[model samples]
Target: MEISLILNNELVWDKEFKSCKEYVSNLKSLAPNEVKMREMEAKFLNLVNTDKDVSKYYKIGGALCISLLTNTTFAYADTLGGVSDKLKTIVSPLIELLAGLGYPVTYGMLITGFIMVIMGKKSKGIDIIKWACIGYVGLQFVPFILNILELIGRELRNSL
Candidate 1:
């Protein structure tokens, strides 16, 4: 179902708190438990799934939210792609720097830890090696983690 159509039928989805006073008043109408609130959410998901034009509705909803938040018109259907491209541009330098530095730093740490261990500072060497391993994995694994998160978000959006 179109978001506006649903909102027109039930104001709960459109209920934005205007003030502490309004929030207090609305509290009385709130679902008693998380399950009740989730049932409403399920109804929304079902409606969107049954609606043939849900994608168009999503574009309008996304635009409206972006416009409201930024105080500007932003109704483009390709907004997500545009944002992703911009993000890649912004993050490219950081990724390049990480690729350049991570390997050398990791190797250096490992070598230093080995030297320390050979000099009988076993505890310090092990600590250094542990930190180096963690840092190297984190540096290399960030993109994979982000990919997983993006997949999850996409699935949720598609479900809607």
Candidate 2:
């Protein structure tokens, strides 16, 4: 009979089995003969090497595998943590100073721009307001952008 695994009102898995032991046995018997496995591996490699798109995907998969394997060691990460601690000691105060100043600058520019526009100096006022708004939004994204760049750099370093 068919066996089904349901979870949260969804069919998670469905298979045919005579008994629970048979299901467990089938799961355990996943090994293939060495000669057949080698032949299949060779065939897969040949296919990947011969096809440009497949080769690109294979290279990407290989790079990901290499990155994952290289980053599994904590020794390098501990050194980075030490460096980051040093950098934080130096840069954290500077960052806080800038953040403390940025909001007032943003508000000042916005208020001045609106006042100018209300006084009929429309063109320059609108330009200043637009730039101030853009700067405010851009400042919010700085941390997100830095995080993305850091992730990219780490992956590139690992792949290399």
Candidate 3:
């Protein structure tokens, strides 16, 4: 249950914390500048590389958890109120990429599954074919689902 705090490539604090909140508070108090914060960030990166023990201790949010470690304005994100169009613009590339890859993969899977059926793996082949068709239909529905969500969001935003 020992924690080592490194600053400027040297260990400055080595002790045990009774709780994760205490550890986080101590960490926040220990690193007050960009350099120290960067060092702390590097330590976290190293922890991510070595083991997932750090994740067990900090079980809050996703990458947003890193923002809580800093007070800089740039670390925070704004509400999605004014960014609907921007979100669509960003997601367009993903939808395009999905459409580009979807057909070929689905067809390939269908052909492979048919081959497996001819090769005597009947149940496995049928399962593969079923899954491939399901995936294809789900992907085909993606744009429609997103459109419905967009419409809902628009109505909510307009009502507000």
Q: What's the TM-score of every candidate structure?
A: 0.46, 0.47, 0.47
Query: Where does candidate 2 stray beyond 4 Å?
Result: 1-85
lDDT of 2 by residue, 1-160 (tens): 9889999999999987578888789878986789999999999999998999999999878877888988752233456646866887799889878867778999999999999999999998999999999998898888789879878877787787
Residue 57 lDDT (model 1): 97
**lDDT, model 2:** 0.85
Better of 1 and 2 by TM-score: 2
* Number of clashes found in candidate 3: 0
Q: What is each predicted model's overall lDDT from 0 to 1? A: 0.83, 0.85, 0.83
lDDT of 1 at 139: 85
Q: How many residue pairs clash in each candidate?
A: 1, 0, 0
Candidate 3: Cα lDDT at 66: 67
Name the candidate that leads on lDDT.
2
Q: Clashing residue pairs in candidate 1, if any?
A: 1-47
lDDT of 3 by residue, 1-160 (tens): 8889999999999987578888788888876799888999999888876777777555435545665676433433656754767777888898799787988999999999999999999999999999999999999998899889988987898899
